[model samples]
Target: MEYAQLGRTGLKVSRLCLGTMNFGPQTTEEDSHAIMDRAHELGLNFFDTADVYGWQKGEGITENIIGRWFAKGGGRRERTVIATKLYGDMGDWPNDGRLSALNIRRAADASLRRLQTDHIDVYQAHHIDRNTPFEEFWEAMEVLRQQGKILYVGSSNFAGWHIAKAQETARRRNFLGLVSEQSPYNLLVRAPELEVIPACEDYGIGLIPWSPLFGGLLGGVLRKLDRVRSAASDLVTELERNREKIERYEAFCDELGEQPSHVALAWLLHRPAVTAPIIGPRTVEQLDGTIRALEVKLDDKALARLDEIFPGHRPAPEDYAW
Candidate 1:
C-alpha cells in the first residue's frame, strides 16, 4: 500500500482508493463490511463513495452501510481517508441536487450523518454544475472548512476548462481550491491525457482515475468469453468494438505473466500525477487480489508496447494542430 500526498496537501492517501459504489447495490451490508475490513487489513486507507451510490434516492444505503462499519469502532474512521460526492439527487425537492450553496450545505450535513463521522476528508462535486457559479461553490466549501465539516475540496467529471475556471475563482477568493479530480481514464479511454491531466498538473490537483480498466473492458475481456456473452448488451457492444486491441492486450499480459486487471491498474499507477486508482470489488477475495497491482511494475518497454496497442492523446495543440 503505497501512499501519496493528496494533491498539494500534506495529507497522504493510499495509492489504491477503495471504491464503495457496489455496497448495498451489488453487495450486501455484511459483505461490504467484510471487504472494508479486508481493505484496512491490507493497508488501504483511502475510501471513495458518493451519497447517491446506493441507488436509493434519499436513503443513502451505501453510506449507511459504511457508517455501521465505522460505528464498530477500532479506529476505522480515524485511520481511513474517506471521500464522498454530492451533486446527485438525494430527494425529490428542488434543493436535492446540484452544487448550489443550499444543496452543498444540506448535502454535506446529510452525508456526515449517514457516514457516522464528524468530518469528511475530501468532499467532491460528482459533476460540473453548469448553472451554479464557482463563486457559490467555493463559498459553500469555505463554510464547510471553517465549520470543520470537510478538510479538502475536489471535483469529478469536470472538463479541463472547467477546472481552470474553478481554480482561478478560488485563487481570487484566497481559497485552497481543488485538491483532487476523479476522471474516466484507462487504456481504452485516454482522452483525459490530452487536457484534463494537463490542467490538473498545472493546478496541483491529484488525479484519482475512476474506471481505471474502462469498465472491465481492459481486464482481459476476451479471455472471459463466457462472461462477455452474458454481459450487459451495452458492455458487450463495447467489447466487440475493441475486440482486436483487447486480444493483443491479453496476449501482452500473458507474456508478462500478470493478470490483465493488474496490468491495467499498473499502467495507471505508472502515469504522472495520478494519486490513485479507485478499485470497486464485490468480494473480499477480489479486494485482496488487487494488492498485486501495486507490485506489478511496468518498465519502459511494456509501457511503449501498451502505447502502441492503445494510442493516447498528446498535449493539446500537438494532439490537434502543430
Candidate 2:
C-alpha cells in the first residue's frame, strides 16, 4: 500500500483507509477484527469509523468494537492512525448532537471511552450543522485540541463554501482549522472535482474520499439488482434513476479492461487532490477486490475515456444548494 501526507498535518497515512462502518450490524466482531488484522499485515495503517456507523439502532457499535480490539492488547492500536467523527444525531434530544462546546466535550469523552484511547488521531465534524455558527463549532473543536483529546480536525460532506467559511473563521479567531475533508468521490461521482477538490487544493487541506466505489455500484456486482440489494441500501431506487448511466459506466470499464471497482478507485487515486479513499468491506473477499484497485494504474487515455463517459459532471442530486 502507498502512503501519503495527510494534508498539512504532517501525518502519514495509508493511501487506502480501512473504514469500519459495517462492523457491528453487517459484519461480526470477529470478522471486523480479522479484517483489521489483515489490513495491518498488508501495511495499511489508517482506520476510519464514526459514532453513527452500523445499524440505525446500534449507533456506536463500530467504535465499541475498536475499543475492545484496543483493550485486548491489540498492538495495532499504537501503530495505526484512527479517525472518527461526531455531530450526527444519535437520539431525539434537541441539543444532544450539534457541534457546540457542550456536545463536543460530551462526544469526545464518549468516543475516547469507547475507543479505549486517550486521543483521536483525527476528529471530524460529520457534517455541517447549519444551526451552529462556524465560529462556535470551530471553537468547540479547538477545545478538544487544547485538551489533547484530538490531534487534528477535519470536515465531512461539507461543500466548498462551508470549508472556506470554516477556514476563514479559524483564521480570524487564531484557531486550528480543518486539515482534511472526507467526501464521496469515484468514477461515477466526479462532483467533488467541480468545487471541493479545487478548494482543498488551494487551502492545502487533504481530501479523503469515501464511497470511492460509489457504494458498490462500480463493484461489478451492481449490474444485477439482487446483488446490489445484498450490498447496499437505496441501490434499487438509485438504479431505477440511472440504469442507463450504470450500463454505460460498465461498458467504459470493460473497454479499459479493468473491473468496475478497480477503475472506480483508480480514477480517484489518479487525482492530485485526493489523499486517500476509505474502503469499507463486510468480508475479506470484498476487501481483497478493493485492495487490488491500488495497483491498477490508469493512464491518460483511460482517464480521458472515463471522463468522456461520465463527463466529470456533478449529478443534480449531489449538488449543494448552499
Candidate 3:
C-alpha cells in the first residue's frame, strides 16, 4: 500500500494497480467484484481497464460490472483512482475508435456512464495512432480536462520518441501531457530499459508495467506444468523457448525462499521509474496474496544477480557505442 506521486503530478497512487481486464472474460462478475473489494482492503487504490477488455464490440461488460460494485456503495468509487483506455475498435464505424477528438469526447462520456462516475482519474490511449497528430490528441484531452471529465492523460505501447513528441506538443499547448505510460515491462522483458524508461524518466512520466510476471513464466511456471498443459498452445511454445531462463529465475527465487510471483513483482517495485505494476488476478485469493510483494526486499547482490540472469540495456547510444 505504498503511495507514490504519479510522475510529476501531485496525485498519489498505490504501488500495485488492480487490472480489471479479466472482469467479464476469465472471471465471473461476482468473483471480479470480490477481487476488487479485496484489492481495496489491501490498500490498492489504482485500477486499470480498457473499453475493449470485454472483447465484445461496443459492449463494456467489465465496466458495467465495476459500475455495479460501485453502486453498492461503502465509498467504493470515492476511494479508487480509476484508469481506463481507448483506441480499440468499439464498432464497425470509422469514428468509433482511435485518438481523434470526436472519438475522445464520445468515448469519455460512454466510459463515464459505464463506470457510473463523473470523472476518470486517468484517461489513456491504448495504443499510439500513427495517423493522428499529437496536437489533435492533446487538444481533445485538454477539452476533457476543462470539462472535468478526466484529470490526467496517459499513453500505452508508445515508443520512446513517441513519448518525446507527445510531451513537446503538450508543452506547446500548456497542458499536463502524459503523467503515466503503461508498457509491457518485467524481469525478462528488459527492452524498455534501452529507451522507453529513459524517456519516461526524462518527461516525469510514471511507468505502469503490465505483464510483470511474463504471463506466469516468472511465476514458477515449472511447478505448474499441469496448468500449462491446459493453457493456450502459444503459451506452451513461449514456455519452451524461455524454459532455461525461467528455470534459473525460479532457482534464484527458491534461494531467497519466496514465491516466484512475489519476486517478479518485487523486482518491478524496486525499479526507479515504476510507479506501479498492474496485477490482473482472477480471484480474491490471488489478490490477497499480492500484498506479500511489498515485503520481499531485494538488496544490491540480489539485484545484481537478477541483472546477470537477464541483462538489461544501458541508456541509448551508450549501450550501442563507446
Candidate 4:
C-alpha cells in the first residue's frame, strides 16, 4: 500500500483506511479478526471506528470486537494506526454525547477500554457540537494529549468555516488543532469540492473521505441490482436520480477493463487534499478487492471524462460569486 503524510503531520498512513463500522453488526468476531489480519498483512495500517458503531444492537459493540482482536497478542496493536470517534448518544443522559469537556473525558476513557489500547492514534469528534464552545472541546482534548491518551485530534462532517474556526481556536490556545477531516466524497457526491476541500487545503488538514463509492452506486450497483433485486431505499433513489451518468461511467469503466469500484477509489486518490478514503468491506474477499484500486490510475483523458460526468463545484468565493 502506498503511504502519505496525514495532512501536515509527519505521521505516514496508508492511502486506503479500513473502516470498522460493520464489525459487529454485519461481520462476526472471528471474521472481523481475519479481515483485520489480512489488512495488516497487506500494509493497510490505518483503521477507523466510532464509539457509536454497531448501530442496531448497541454502541461500542464494534470497538469491543476490535478489543478482542487486539487482545490476541500478535503485535496487531503495534502495526496499526487506530482512529476512532466520539460525539454520539451513548446513553440516555444529555451529556452522554457531544463535545462537552466532561463527555470528551468520559468518552476517551470508554474508547480506550473498548479498543484494549492505552492510547489512540487519532481521536475525532464525530460531528460539530453547536452547544459546546470550541474552547471547551479543545481544552479537554489538550488534556488527553498531555496525558498521552490521544496523539492527535480530527473532525468529521464539518463545514468549511467549521475547520477554519477550529484551527483558529487551536492556534490561539497553542494547541495542535485538527489534523484531518472525514466527509462523504465520491464520484456521485462532489459537494465537498465546493469549500471543504479548499479549506482543508488552506489549513494543511488531510482529507479522509468516507462513502467514497456512494453506497455502492459507483461499485457496479446496477449489475448487482440486476441479480439481487433489492436495495436500500435511499440508495435506490440516488441510483434513479443519476442513472444516465452512471450508465456512461459504467461504460467508461468497461472500456478500461476495471471494476467501477476500483475506478471510483482511484479517482478519489487523485484529488489534491485527500490522504485516504475509508473502505468498509464486510468480507475477506471484499477486503481484498480494495487492493486492486491502487493499481487503476486514471490518465488525463479518463479524468476529463469523469469530470464531464460529475462536474464538481468551483472553490468557494468564485463558485458563489457568479
Candidate 5:
C-alpha cells in the first residue's frame, strides 16, 4: 500500500482508506474482522466509519463491530489511523444529531466508547450543519483536541464555500482547521473536480473520496450487464445513459490487462489533490483484489484516453463560466 500525508499534517495514512459502512448490514462481523485483518496484512492502515452507520438495525452497530475487533487484543488499534463521523440522527431526541457543541461532545464520547479507542485519529462532521456556528463547532473540537480525544478534525459532504468558511474560521481562531474532506468522487461523478477539489487544494486539506467506483458503475459493469440490469433504478438508468462509453472503457481495461476497478482506482490516485480513495470491500477476496491497483500505472496515453472516454473537469469558475 502507498502512504501519503493527511493534508498538510505530518501524519501518514494509507492511500486507500478502508470504509466499514457495510460491516453490520451487508457484511457480518466475522467477515468484517477478516477483511480488516487482510487490510492490515496488505498494509492498509486507515479505516473510516460513522456514528449513524447501520442505522436500519440500530445506530453504531458498525462501530460496535469495530469495537469488538479492537477488543480482540491485537495491534489493531495501534497500527490504524481511525476516522469516524458524527452529525446524523442517533435517536429521537433533538440533541441526538448535528454539530451542536453538546452533541459534538456527547457524540465524541459515545464513538470513543464504541470504537474502543482512547483517541480518534480523525473525527469528522458527516455533513455541513447549517444551524451551528463555526465558532461553536470549533470550540467543541478544541476541547476534544486539548483533552486528547481526537488528533485531527475533518469534514464530509461539504461545499467549496463551506470548506472555505470553516478553514478561515479555524485560521482566525488559531485552530488547526480541517485536515481532510471526504467527497463522493469517481470516474462517473466528476462533480467534485469542479469546486471542492480546488477548495481542498487551496486549504491544504486532503481529499478522501468515497464511492470512487460510482456504485460499481465503473467497476466493469459491462461484464455483469445482466446483473447491472437488476441493480437499483437510478444505477441502471446511469448505466443505460453511459452504456457506450462504459463498453469502450472496459475494452480499454481489457487491452491493458487490468481490472476496470483497479484502473479506476489508479486514475484517482493520479489526481494531484486526492490523498486517498475509500474502498469498502465486502469480502476478503475483493479486498485483496484492490491491492493490484497500486502497481497498475496509468501512463499519459492511457490517462488521455480515459479523459476522452469519460471527459475531464475544468477547475471551478471556468466550469461554470463561459
Candidate 6:
C-alpha cells in the first residue's frame, strides 16, 4: 500500500484507513482483531474509529475494543496510527455533547482511558457543533494539543465554509488549525468536489473520505436488482431507499470493468487532495475487496468513462444537511 502525509501533521498514513465502526455491532471481537491483523499485514498503518460506534446504547465501545486489542500484547498497538473522534451525543446530558472546553477535556480523558493510550495520533470533531462558538471549540482543541493529549486535530463532516471559519479562528487565537478533513467522497458521491476538495487544496488540509463505496453500493454485491433489493433491506435504510442513486452506481461499476468498491475507491485515490479513503467492512472478505481497490488504477479514459456513467449528480434538496 502506498503511504501519504496526513495534511501538515507530518504523519505518514496508508492510502486506505481501516474504519472500525462495525466492531461490537455487526462484527465480533475476534473478527475485528483478525481484520486489524490483516490490515497490518497489508501495510495499512492508519486506523479510524469514533467513540459513538460499536454500540447503540452508548459511546466508546469501539475504543474499548481497541483497548482489548492493545492488552493482548501482540505488537499491534505499537505499529499503527490510531485516529478517533469526539463531540457526538454520548448521553451525558442535553448540550453536554457539543465542542465546549469541558466536553473536549472530558472526551479526551474518556477516549484515552478506553483506547489505553497516552496520546492519540489524530483527534477529530465528529461533526460541526453549531451550538458552540468556533473560538471556544478551537481554543479547547489547542489546550488538548498543549496537554499532549492529541498529536493533531481534524474535522469530519464539515463544509468548506465551516473549515474556513475554524482556520480563521485558530489563526486569530494562535491555536493549531485543522490539519485534515474527513468527508463523504466517492465515485457515487462527488458532492465534496463542489466545495470541500477545493478548500482542502487551497489550505493544505488533507482529505480522508468516509463511505467511499457509498455504503456498499459500489462493492459489486448490489449489481442485480434482487440483490440490491435484498441488501437494501438489511441496514442503513437511506442508501437502500435511493433507487436512482443505486442504479447510477451500478452502471458506473459496470463501465469500469471493476468491482463497485474498486471503482469507488480508485476514483478517490486518483484525486490529489484526498489523503486516504476510510474502509469499513463487516467481514474479512469485504475488507479484502476494499483492499483490492488500491490496485485498480484509473487513467484519463477510464475516469471519463466513469464520469459519463455517473455524471455530476448532487444530493437532492432533502439530503443536503449532515
Question: What's the residue-level lDDT of 40 in candidate 4?
Answer: 95
- Among all windows of 10 consecutive residues in model 1, the one with the lowest summed lDDT is 214-223
Q: Mind sharing the TM-score for model 3? A: 0.99
CA lDDT for candidate 3:
0.93
Q: For candidate 2, lDDT tens digit of each residue in 206-270?
A: 99999887766777755566776764568667766677777888887788788888878888888
TM per candidate comes to 0.99, 0.91, 0.99, 0.98, 0.98, 0.89
Report lDDT per candidate: 0.95, 0.84, 0.93, 0.93, 0.93, 0.82
TM-score of candidate 5 against the unseen true structure = 0.98
- Model 3 C-alpha RMSD to native: 0.8
Q: Model 4 over residues 1-322: C-alpha lDDT tens digits?
A: 8999999999999999999988988999999999999999899999999999987423689999999999999899999999999998898887888899999999999999999999999999999999899999999999999999999999999999899999999999999899999999998888899889999999999999999998888998778886434767788888888999999999989999999999999999999899999999999999998899999889999999999988888897887796
The candidate, 3 or 6, that scores higher on TM-score is: 3
* Residue range 131-223, candidate 1, lDDT tens digits: 999999999999999999999999999999999999999999999999999999999999999899999999999999999988889888887
Clashing pairs in 6: 218-260, 218-261
Encode model 3's per-residue lDDT on 96-183: one tens digit a residue: 9999999999999999999999999999999999999999989989989999999999999999999999999999999889999999
lDDT of candidate model 2 versus the reference: 0.84
* Residue-level error in angstroms, candidate 4, position 25: 0.8
Model 4 RMSD in Å is 1.1
Ranking by TM-score: 1, 3, 4, 5, 2, 6
Model 4 misplaced regions, further than 4 Å = 56-58
State the local distance difference test value for candidate 1.
0.95
* lDDT of each residue in 1-322, candidate 6, tens digit only: 8999988667899999999999998899899988888888889999999878876535578899988897788788888899999877777576457688888888888889999988888999999988889988878877888888898889999998999998888889877688899998876677887778877887789999998877666666555556566664643465556556667767766766677777778888998689999988788887776777888988898887777766754333324555
